[model samples]
Target: MDSGKARATPSFSAVRTKRAFEAVTDQIRTQLANGLLRQGDRLPAERELAEQFGLSRNTVREGLRALEVAGLVELKKGATGGAFIRRGQAEVVVSSFSDLYRLGAIRAEHLTEGRLIVGTAVTRLACQRATLEDIDLLQENVDDSAGSDAQTALSVNLDFHRLLARATSNPVLIVLTDALIGVQRELLKIYEPASQIDVIASRRRLLTHLRSRDEVAAVSEMEQHLRLLQSHYLEEDFRYRRRVAAEAKAAGEAASDEA
Candidate 1:
């Protein structure tokens, strides 16, 4: 045991140089992001990939495995399925937020606050810079949301916010808004499945303000809308905790009676 421990410590340091497989992985990732590789695009065969990268087959396999874990690619077992780049990654990002919520790392209130601040800021920019096309894109989302189910409404609402983020012309703001939107969508689904909020009307009001070139009104409307959504989550959490506390009290009384 003492000999094994001594050998492991040195072995870890000795292999500190860049791994061949990791280099290949980076190259593949860059290609994927650069449109050289796209969704449903089959990668070169394993043997060909190894030759092209000047790497061993084992190294290529390892890189593919890493990509699979990252949700960037899928590995199919049947002959029909071989490493396709994943499509519609919004679900993956949404699932990532689920894990954080499960761990209590982030909560509904935090996401709600993030949405309020970011939404208001983005609205101001959108009001100033929205093109005719931008307004049409947002109106399209609202039109789709009208009379749709909760799931469909949530998707369209997210699209509306994303359009607003794009109008800002800031890549950083767009990405950050997307992550915050993911969190807000998850919270809405969990806390307010059928909670009526007049979503279509609210969205229409916001767009109207923006179209009128009213930055102040746009920001005000956004903050109010996000706060309304926040209230739903807050009430849901309160009700859930109250229900749990009541159940515990009932259980305690039953136990005392049995004793």
Candidate 2:
């Protein structure tokens, strides 16, 4: 027996007609969980899958589409293209979080709180695990924020957190940080920039603490910085609401005068 031989295709069983596509997905997922299928393995052709599952080709395609949307598989094009198992991506989580925010399931306050918790943990880990090169890259990020315009400064500042997350050397944390930051970016669009906050100075201080391997100080600095940012966001949101209300009132009065 060839121990290193790979399975060419998964053996799918017949599924009933009721919710047939879901059954198809469930079997594929089970194959994945059981190690019968692995990443980069090309699934059988649609006709073959349909026969195996005792379903129509359209049903099999629907199942594949669901898997693709869930980030479980990649559907490629051309004669060489088929449904191939794909590696997990951070964007899936980021998209899910962004959707939650859009549906009002995640509010600004929830996002800020989540950032504070994750940022502090990431900061502590970075202080312990960061290499000299990582620290240097972070320093460069901070330097780029200096004297930048509001938009440029925001971009650099966000990159600084991403760099810090990478310093942890943990893929899971990196994904989580990316997701939280992604949603926060959307929230930031509703309010004005953090022009009043001295972000560069705080980052500089955090960098010093990271270099010294002072986990306590680094975590403290990160928490304080996030709190200040949250305060600014809340104040800006209030001002934005008030301004909108005043504008509506003025518009209504002007229309009355015209009448």
Candidate 3:
């Protein structure tokens, strides 16, 4: 018998007790959510967390890594190096959505629908609640977009949406909307350089509507702007699907010939 086979399977009971890194991550997340940990609060040393949880240092490290990616904790180095709670983290939430899109877990239509719902709501709220400062911020973004290259313009355009969301003064809405838009921005990775002209014109129109404070017009403009943006992605998706179907048909024919 092979040495490994001779050793026999580990007892089911032993395997059942095996540690999972995600379990440790969940516990830390629970602590943070329960307010047992507050922003800027430092976590116990890694060795302490490991010992407390009856886990290896590597298990504890994995938990910290998860929390760090989630934007819940920050690990710093220097005289003081430990995990600390973070304040509001809309960007991280957004990036997480982007990752999902890249993995083919989300589609272009999902992004378009999210944009319609969130974009319209935020535009309406900004119309009613935006202060002079908020309007100025939007104008600044418009100016920045005018001279930016394609990629830079996309960044500024996303920033403009973030500023508009913040102008609503609803932290929950801002965070949630940013999360959806973040996914859309990630998908834009393939199309940004080609979208320069559309982005420039869209930014200009949004600023105009906001400046005029026409709530109805602003909302309408936003919807139309997003429609234009969605069209580009939809076209790409249509092409991709066609290509995939052709490849599948070709593969089927090859298999039949082999048989």
Per-model TM-score, in order, reads 0.65, 0.88, 0.74
Off by over 4 Å in 1: 1-56, 71-92, 144-155, 193-198, 248-259
Residue 159 alpha-carbon offset, candidate 1, angstroms: 3.7
**Could you give candidate 1's per-residue lDDT for residues 4-57 as a string of tens digits?**
222211100111225977776677776766556667667767777777777678
Return the clash pairs for model 2, or none. none
Window of ten residues with lowest summed lDDT in model 1: 7-16
* Winner by TM-score: 2
Error of 3 at 161 (Å): 1.7
Per-residue lDDT of 47 in model 2: 99
Better of 1 and 2 by TM-score: 2
Candidate 1 global lDDT: 0.75
| Residues 43-148 of candidate 3: C-alpha lDDT, one tens digit per residue | 7788877777777779778878888887888889877888887776787867777888989888888887788888889999998999999999888888888888
Q: List the residue pairs that clash in candidate 1.
A: none
Per-candidate local distance difference test: 0.75, 0.89, 0.77
TM-score computed on alpha carbons, candidate 3: 0.74
lDDT of 2 by residue, 71-123 (tens): 99999999999999887688889999999999989877888888898999999
Worst 10 residues of 2 by lDDT: 1-10
